[model samples]
Target: MTRKPPPDTTPDGHHVVIGGRRWRATDPAIPDDVGARLRVHLMAARRAVGVALRAHDPEAERAARDRVQSAKVALGERGTPWWEQSPEERRTRWQDGLAALDAQGAQGAQDA
Candidate 1:
């Protein structure tokens, strides 16, 4: 839900404008920290994929990069933001990605 408009006037004697309408802090539908952390997680995930790409095996690296891209799209569409997602959801995604990476690494090891 959106924040209710504040009855008080803005500094210029106008209603606070946000998202094309007046807005207030009361019942803030979104949190600053949540957005910040989501960006951080997204950055970290991107970095992980980059590191994976440096691997010697081009095919394995491509798979890891693809997984990262898919994860990023999913996170963006979640609406509530990644950091705001429940702990279980976050942990599950992390574990799944890590597992995929581990598998790729193991395959590389076998090839070596």
Candidate 2:
């Protein structure tokens, strides 16, 4: 299988271009470890959304989507534009986001 190339970024690097569409890019300032964890949560939440949809569970789908939003916002791909935020704000955003996602994972494990 061939892997797709990385998306092209705008000159300013705040957004990526894919299929002639623009999407916010993840914050460059995020540490590698934190970013990886956030991506894990994002993918898991996405999978959960699909599972919920297949089961016809609206409540579960909503919850999964909420997780997706949280992960995106934490990664600086959503909410306030990362470039517009101060350094401290950027750090806090990712740190808090990781904490929240971690807690959610723990809670889910316990429930299961």
Candidate 3:
């Protein structure tokens, strides 16, 4: 027999209980597709940071951390929510973030 996990809801999605402290969960206003894409970037950067640490490469670690920050910002967890912005403004935010990610990839290729 198996038992189901307890509920995690607070007000938004799920309340993350860590060391007896409650924190805001990931931003929910992010569109599904964009959220998934950003998570991919976040995970890749996280892994890269770990690998860089093992390899003792501080420059690569810093770059990977930058990627992690960018992904979080784009996913609406850093600054104001995208939906809260005007239409034109929201579009610009997405474009710039995504373009930066692409540029990071290109830079990685050049470095390799």
Largest TM-score belongs to which candidate?
Answer: 2
When summed lDDT is taken over every stretch of 10 residues in candidate 1, the lowest stretch is 23-32
Ordered list by TM-score, greatest first:
2, 3, 1
Candidate 2, residues 1-112: lDDT per residue as tens digits? 9999999999999999999999999999999999999999999999999999999999999999999999999999999999999999999999999999999999999999
lDDT of 2 at 7: 95
User: Which runs in model 3 stand beyond 4 Å of their true positions?
Assistant: 1-9, 12-21, 80-91
Clashing pairs in 1: none
Q: Candidate 3 — worst ten consecutive residues by lDDT sum?
A: 6-15
Report model 1's TM-score to 2 decimal places. 0.34
Q: 1 or 2: which has the higher lDDT?
A: 2
Q: Give the Å shift of residue 44 in candidate 2.
A: 0.1
Q: Residues 1-112, candidate 1: write the lDDT tens digits.
A: 8997655545644234665665422112223554344445456556756776676666656665565554443333332344455766655554554455446556756976
Error of 2 at 76 (Å): 0.3
What lDDT, from 0 to 1, does candidate 3 have? 0.72
Stretches > 4 Å off in candidate 2? 1-3
The clash count of every prediction, one per candidate, is: 0, 0, 0
Instruction: Report the number of the highest-lDDT candidate.
Output: 2
Over 1-112, each residue of candidate 3 has an lDDT whose tens digit, in order, gives 9996743646545344555676445555556776687788789899999999999999989989999889767765567655467766655665577678878877888988
Please identify model 1 stretches exceeding 4 Å from their true place. 1-61, 67-80
Q: Ten consecutive residues with minimal summed lDDT in candidate 2?
A: 4-13
